[model samples]
Target: MSEFADRIRPHAPTRDDASARRWIYVPYDRLTDATGPLTEQPASQTGIVMMEALAKAHRRPYHKKKLALILASQRHFALKQARRGIKIIYEFTPGIFADGLEQATRHHRLSALTMMQPAEREMSLDVEEARVRGIPLQLVEDTTWCSTESDFDSVFAPTTKHFLMDRFYRRMRQKTGILMQPNGEPIGGKYSYDAENRRPYRGQPPVPERPRFHPDSITQEALHLVAREFPSHFGTLDGFDLPVTQAQADEAWSFALEHLLPHFGPFEDAMAHNEPDLFHSRLSALINISRLLPRRLIDDVARAAHSERIPLASAEGFIRQILGWREFMRHLHRRTDGYRQLPGQRNNSSSDDPYAGAEPSALNAHRPLPAAFWGRRSGLHCLDTVIDQVWREGWSHHITRLMVLSNLSTLLGVSPRALTDWFWIAYIDAYDWVVEPNVLGMSTFADNGLTATKPYVSGAAYIHRMSDYCGHCRYNPRKATGDASCPFTSLYWSFLDRNADNLSSNPRMSMPYVTLRKKPASELNELRKRAAQAIEELCHAQQASPQE
Candidate 1:
């Protein structure tokens, strides 16, 4: 019934078949059990050190509650696999986990080992290492996500056309034939009801709810271990109701259906200052784990929509998160194969600049950006300020994350690496596949032309259009050119001017830059002065923060 049974069905090595059975073991953070190779491979705990070092670099303990969440999850998976009659050995390494995989094989007498594709850097490292050693290796489909690699590659390989999400989405519909009629046609004369999904709550609609679950003994034990081991972590564990088992995860998913899915489509991108869970189905963590599969999740959502148990938009949106975005990320990450080296991936690209030279490179790679890249806890410092706040909450709406944090990161040149890693470490929902592409490629432009046709760089006006943040903040989102001017206004112009050779030559940016140049001389001078002054204040602020 499980993917493991299928992979090793006829080839399973038993005592009758061989005198000794050894394997390469990987403990997944999401799945309940540990997995091993039917072949020979060595294993270690280096992933623990990398996890610990990441926290230490950020001045948070390796045992911090957030870090603890991952460690606890992985540890539990290892134990589960062991109970199910699999071999697992743990080791510690500071660099990539794949290096440990390689080392384990070298040290062992076994022929070769099997492993899962790691969540971050070192996927290729493991595969290549296996090849170099002339050892047989098995690459398994990560059952955590529903789509297989072949599914995405096949869909993408057909035409020489540029990838469009909508096209792939349509094909997925035809293949699964979800919400379609028996005649192989779509329901309601349309495949998408996106237009009906976008209503800003005027407080008139009934307030939808998120499923609430009490942690059972297993999750409770994990919570206690996290608190005890990482006393200095950033988040509070008082409200620890995270789903840890498949049954519990199913309950959590069902709860999303009953309480949240109806409204998810409309407010999916909306954000409120203190509202962390606005019409969101927060099952990414479990989805990343093996307890749930995206295909099944998508199928369930389609059923809900066809049955009219939920609105089409809400169901469609949910499916996109699981089926579209999550699946695309896996393929993108695997295809890129340049995860760690990408600019600003593990650290801010800004940190590599001379001004940020003395900053700890490793720290910058993994930790949040220095607060100074923003304002004095005031204006230009929006992304850092917003992210620091989010670290405590472990959640925020998509708009808040993108428009406020990701947009600000791009405008501030926070560097793709640092921003991407921050998104990866801070969000409970983050996995390498999703976080890297969104943060590195979409948010920060670290991956160049990988995901987006262009970087999503924007200023305060976009923020104001989407949310109420501008009204509550001190900076003037409107005033374009002076000390009182919103930092985004001047900084935005400055970015365009500075990168004109790189940006304006483009076909898409010509109009916006032309518009900026149309400003009067006096206004342009004011914009320059305001932007420069803001940078100075920011530099001073960075100098004042405590270093790790």
Candidate 2:
């Protein structure tokens, strides 16, 4: 695996906490959005940062790069606390998540602690951990985002089962009154304006340039340290944007609100060939870790949209992203068997060991996580191209994750274990909670249609329609008949053709499949052949290269 993580392991205290007195407990942060000025700093240092530095020095540059980014970013946050005179400790756990209070209390020997995280499940885990560990825990409000837990939950009671985002979102519109009519109804008598949200950028060469914050001295030192430590991972330190302080994070948030939030709605779902960050908020990693708050970001954008300063469609779109998808995902992970092995997926049922599986589990088919996909015989480049792309860019718009990369992995019949493992390795924003749902549930269809209704599959034409990638692409979207035809084109048609026996009858897909089935059989046969060839070429190229 990754040398950055492998070389650095968590240090267990040799002596028990029976003698300790003075301490400040700081939880691990995957997304520093939780650690605003309000939360107490974690009182220890987990040496993942130094390990990342060493790995960068000794390992292959790709492996080093990705690991370095995570460690550097985390290290930057840790340094921020030190300058404030907080007695911070960074514990180097195998995982970056300090997820529950029990883990924090037990691991750090804490008598009392304060956290400013907004995710309820994580808070619930902390509470239970505190109860079991006999430590006092306070759920301090996080100021990084615009909204608060109380504000969001004010729309809820402890035992309500019928709550959905639409109602909650309406409350948001009313509370913020962003797009309200002068008479007090939402402007246009409706709060959600999603209809105008998905237009393809149908214009000329006028894409806005992303503002680059060239690595500052602090970021540069962290980058050099990471590169020197973890040399075998992925990514480049060239565009590292780790906001060490809340003020910096706020500044980054302001840039997004003032410049990107308006057009965020229409082009949010749109993805082109290589433009992964297109109008999308690159704030997830920051938000996830407590560097910024989603509520305030939501409020600011919502107020702007409501006041007609930003378009209603844009504001509504942004709100949906924060309220609808992000929060729903958090609750879903906690409430359901999301972290547990369900039905027939695994054996161990205890929630503590998330991967311990369900009931009398099946063979750990998912465990040894077949590296053959990485061995180059798998033909899809799931490990190489996809990993490379994700490492270089901390975030890839959802469509790229779902359509091109994830779709190829599914169609290539690569195991979900391998696909998700790659996601775990690559994304800067990945954590067990968020990454698992998108990877296993949405991309790999490992959840068996829980997170998404069906697998997202596409060939070239669709990818071409959404962005400018096709214009510079080596393959042709229109050519289903020859080598010039994108492998995606034929593969897409062929996948639908092959899966038609199962997918065609499904109500949601009948419309598309019916149209596809009418195409000439000869055309489809040719398309399948091209896809296979393309797959073979990709496999050969990746494997022959020294990187894999």
The alpha-carbon lDDT assigned to residue 357 of candidate 1 equals 15
> In model 1, where do residues sit more than 4 Å from their true spots?
1-26, 30-63, 74-119, 123-137, 155-163, 179-199, 204-239, 339-376, 379-385, 505-511, 543-548
Candidate 2 ranges with C-alpha deviation above 4 Å: 1-24, 30-85, 90-110, 113-187, 202-205, 239-242, 272-276, 339-389, 539-548
- Give the best candidate by TM-score: 1
Judge candidate 1 at residue 522 and give its lDDT. 84
- Measured against the true structure, the TM-scores of the candidates, in listed sequence, are 0.74, 0.71
Model 2: weakest 10-residue lDDT segment is 46-55
Candidate 2 is scored at a TM of 0.71
Tell me the alpha-carbon RMSD of every candidate. Answer: 7.9, 7.6
